[model samples]
Target: MLKMAKKHNMCFALIKLSQTHKQQLPAWLHCGALLRTYHKLKDACLKQIHEVKSIKDLLKVSNRPTTVPHHWESHDCICGLCVSDRLAGCKNPHKCISTVAVIINNLTPKFNPFYCPINDGLTLTHCRLEKNTRARTQHRGDIIFDPSVSETLQLAECFRIFAGDTRTAQAPAHRLQRPNQGQGQQEPPIEIYTDSSCINNGKNNAQCGSGIWFGENNPLNKAIRITGKTQSNQAGEVAAILIGL
Candidate 1:
């Protein structure tokens, strides 16, 4: 499909629309060669070398009987990952591990890299992406590939929800109806109040949340816990507005 897209002058959006049901094109097509490379590393290297069965395992920090080794001393570790980290001159091998996990778990919007075992290993790339600045932006779930079909589907569904796709039952009504259209009655104005909150505002451990109040007991009401790069009240406010819209 990607070959056909390039061969004929097809817009990328059209390709995405084609795979909206199947979920084949979006992430796979977006990642392409990088996807292949990561999978190859997982299958041919990480699995064989470190016995990684899941993203959780893959992101696990290297724990020796002694304290974690410095980059220069990584050559003495048991795993090839450490040796490679040393060769790459990485000051912290856990950061490298976190990076790989983030790439693979691409579909999760609430992915707190810190939630992983290696909480202190967030890479500079993760930090930059979190800012959501025009200078560096990425569509969160557009570059994931997983061997498990069920897991992939779950991730895709999560991405769709976080991205405000409203096809699912959990979302509010898909289309709002005008009151008394046949009688030419104008639709009444519906008011919605939105707000955001954050704990430990400037700290790394800060948690942000947003709320949408349509009415008491209204199905449209939502309480959202924000995650990822923009873990701030401002971001939560923006998210609340977008979701409400």
Candidate 2:
């Protein structure tokens, strides 16, 4: 009836029609413009639905009291704090904390391998880790540290050698030996060290730099300050490795 009134330039408020007028409206009058309006309305309805669902999920996981102090023990009723902080005046304001209040009070604790702070700061900011964005072929295993074991000490020694610890005056006896094959000894493997640095890391204006080091005073050694919007410590590390290769 409203569509008909609007189409005929009739006053919508003045029309006195019952619910039966809904079916009496011509189907042809509801074709083109009505379909477009319905599509727009559908989008708005879906947006509201998604917003409600997101709020529900957020509240479900959050440790917040959503009601007045008296009704907090009840499971069915929501708190007045959802609408406004002072909606329900009560003495115990602590029992009416919102989700945002709970988050702010707790400082957004870390949950590893998912939503966590990029740095060690106790801020409300978080970074999301999507499973699809990670490499499917590679597996990142857990790390175990034990200084008491002899194998751990041996592994540390090997790591020091691979990382080019110049504190050692000479290479170990095992590393100096060459494999003998048919009366000919094979040459030792070439070792290169690559590293990266990022200043103001985890920020939008972060700067990243990479460096590749061969032997002392080697001509192949290079230092590069990376330039681009894609600047992070990980990106710099990958860039240094690629350049070294």
Question: What residue pairs clash in candidate 2, if any at all?
Answer: 66-79, 67-79
Relative to the true structure, candidate 1 reaches a TM of 0.27
| lDDT score of residue 80 within candidate 2 | 53
Identify the runs in model 1 with alpha carbons over 4 angstroms from their true place.
Answer: 1-185
lDDT score of residue 208 within candidate 2: 96
RMSD of each: 24.2, 28.5
Model 1 misses residue 160 by how many Å? Answer: 24
Tell me the spans in candidate 2 whose CA falls farther than 4 Å from its real position.
1-187
Report the lDDT tens digits of candidate 1 across residue range 160-200.
21232222222111223455567756667989899999998
Least accurate stretch of 10 residues (summed lDDT) in model 1?
Answer: 12-21
What Cα-based lDDT does every candidate model obtain? Answer: 0.48, 0.42
Give lDDT tens digits, candidate 2, residues 11-37: 212111222222232222221121223
lDDT of 2: 0.42
Candidate 2 to truth, TM: 0.25
